[model samples]
Target: MRVKDKIHKLKILRVKAAKAMHADLQHELNAMHVYCHLRGFIGDRDALAFARKWERNIIYSHIIYRSINRSSNA
Candidate 1:
């Protein structure tokens, strides 16, 4: 294939990979939220906030998880 065609194919593949990763992350966040809510570690409002903020920052995600775990343990 020509160089231009190869570049186009790479771009398409990258887009598809990004979309798949996004879907996986969203699924993970949803599962975490549901688990926390069902286990009574957090209420509905806080679970929604956790799911929303989890996507924005990894450090914040860890903090939230630790807090929830600590609260549950206590």
Candidate 2:
């Protein structure tokens, strides 16, 4: 494949990955909000910890998205 085609494919893949990441983050945030609201009622510390972990995952996904964007632009 030509360099241009490879680059284009990479760009498309990057965009799809970014979109999926954003969707995942949004879903996580929504779940987080629900968990926060029910935190007192649930009384399960483990669930809260899981939510926090998901939040961290969302952050990591954002970092990956930015890194891919920067590298692609360069």
Candidate 3:
């Protein structure tokens, strides 16, 4: 395949991977919230908020890693 076609396919794959990551994160956060609620350790809203903060950190790191990789490749 041509370089351009390969780059296009890679971009598509990246998007799909990002969407899958987001869905997986959401499911995990929901489960965490439920577990915390059942254990009476934290309120539902608080648990979700905590999970979301963790999620943001993960996403931010992923973005930084991607930028670093792009720069190094270029």
Candidate 4:
């Protein structure tokens, strides 16, 4: 799915979580983090691809942050 779509869905999920009496706030917070990370990923993906093609110029791509992608990687 697209990053925007994922972000929209996460936002909706957060709203639902907020309305739930037994919802864990941490879960909503984590979802928001993921949503932001996806946005960053969408932003940085282009630059990262360019950097990787040019002999690994960038030491780090904060857009494709490790903390964000770790779960997907696992």
Local distance difference test scores for all models: 0.49, 0.56, 0.52, 0.46
Clash pairs (backbone) in predicted model 1: none
Q: Write the per-residue lDDT of candidate 4 for residues 1-74, one digit (tens) a residue.
A: 66556546654654454455344445545555464565564366653343233212111222234455677888
Model 2 weakest lDDT span, ten residues long: 6-15
- How large an RMSD does model 4 have? 14.4
Task: Tell me the tens digit of each residue's lDDT in model 2 across 18-50.
Answer: 467646657656655564554341454654554
**In lDDT terms, which candidate is top?**
2
Alpha-carbon shift of residue 27 in model 1 (angstroms): 18
RMSD of 1: 17.5
Question: 62, model 4: CA deviation in Å?
Answer: 30
What is the Cα-based TM-score of model 3? 0.43
lDDT of 4: 0.46
On lDDT, who's better, 2 or 4?
A: 2
**lDDT by residue for model 1 over 1-74, one digit each (tens)?**
44345335434533443345324555655555564455454544644464445435543444566687789999
TM-score, predicted candidate 1 vs. hidden true structure: 0.30
Index of the highest-TM-score prediction:
2
* Deviation from native of the Cα of residue 38 in model 1, angstroms: 47
Writing each residue's lDDT as its tens digit, candidate 3 over 1-74 gives 44345335434533554555435545644554454455453544644464455546546646766788789999
